[model samples]
Target: MAKETEIEEKNLLTRNEFDMLADTYQIKPPQFFWQANTYFDTPALEIKEQGAALRVRTKSNNYELTLKQPASAGLLETNQTLTEVEAKRLMEQAELPEGEVKESLHPFIGDTSMLQKLGTLETYRAQTSHETGILFLDHSVYLDTEDFELEIEGSSEEEVRKWLTSILTDHDIPARPTPNKIKRFFTRKQELAR
Candidate 1:
């Protein structure tokens, strides 16, 4: 884990310093976005209720890949358009491959009908594209309110791996390409087993 002080120092970099570092590192400026999701989140009664989603995000003329899933009810309250009551009702009726029921903290029950506006979610995307001999790779980065995503695509898996490794070194960001489980459907069975 980065030490608190280290994070603070990184966050404190002046805009000019950040821009300079980004330029030197071939990193692009951070981009921000607000996405409105309209999905029926699963109820918490099942242990394996967390599901998966696919996102194709773009900014500054660059495109990237994203994978996401529903988290806690609190997370839904902040991201979705449904009121607590509406969400609870939808969750309770949500059909899962493995059937289950929805659940929430006690406080959510009494405040079902009321709606509260959540803040606009912010995200960033970074990318690099290059070719090696006859093969080409397009790499992209994604960040939601909570996590970061890196995706690699090329003529072959090996080329994708090489492309990813090169980006890691250039940006000084430490990460490895997870086993490619990319899928088109956004469902509990299709997503990673998180």
Candidate 2:
């Protein structure tokens, strides 16, 4: 298990802008990979109400469970590596894996058994380092919907914001409001259910 404070700046990007930036940076080939993220929440969304999200991400034949909660800087992320069987059980049966993730989540969600898989989002992502920060380009698909976005992660919020402003301006990419992947997944799921 690992605990870390994540600080990042993100923006919504148009497909054209995403392609333009990628080309300019020469971001191609094996830098990009696919990952599937499965989100979990209570039937009443109690966990979301408390400003927290739980997800299991599968990438490169590895699985990891993560809990994200609001923090002063950005978000507090707690992650735990899971075996294939553990990941399957959690995603298919809503069984909380035993470890730090579950222990930390129990306080926010009283009964772990009530947690169920809400939805899944698949994304193709590429990342590179830029000026003391990491830049991420993402294209995500969920519930027949798709979006392109960019994210910059840094040690400090201010640093990330500064770099993000410059990078977007240089690339001529308009800055737009963007939610995290989980929020977008939930929104799309709701839309599809209607």
Candidate 3:
């Protein structure tokens, strides 16, 4: 398992804006890939209520489980690489993985066996390097809803924020309040359930 703090900024974009930016930056084929993220939480949504999120992502033939919690810089992320067997067990059975990820989660979810699959979000992502940071272009779909977004992750939060602002201003794209994918998914799930 690996642990680190994530520092990133995000902005919602229209499909037209996404395409225009891609063309302008010459972001082509090889830079894009698809990923599927499956989220999990307790029946009472204890994880989210505690301001934490758990997810297992699949890309190509690889799977990884991640736990994200509020942190000083951005979010503290604990990741664990998983085998197909392990991933299937967690996704299908709500079985928590062993090791650091489990240890880190115990404080919040005493008995992880209570965790259950919440929902899934799939995204086609394209990435490029910029002076301010690594820019990620994502087109995501979840619960029959779709969205386009841009994210910049860098060492300096101030620089990334400034750079993102400049880009939005230059392109005439209004920065809307874009909730993170997990939040959006959870909200949609609640909506559909009702």
- Per-candidate TM equals 0.31, 0.97, 0.97
Q: What TM-score does candidate 2 get on C-alpha atoms?
A: 0.97
Q: Which residue ranges in model 3 land beyond 4 Å of their true spot?
A: none
Runs with alpha carbons beyond 4 Å of true place in candidate 2: none
User: What is candidate 1's lDDT per residue for 120-151, written digit by digit as tens?
Assistant: 22334343544642211122122221333445
> Candidate 1's error at 113, in angstroms?
18
- Show the lowest summed lDDT stretch of 10 residues, model 3: 23-32
**Model 1 spans with C-alpha error above 4 angstroms:** 1-21, 24-40, 44-51, 54-121, 126-128, 132-150, 170-172, 176-194
Which lDDT values do the candidates have, in the order given? 0.32, 0.92, 0.91
TM-score of 3: 0.97
Give every collision pair in model 2: none
Worst 10 residues of 2 by lDDT: 184-193
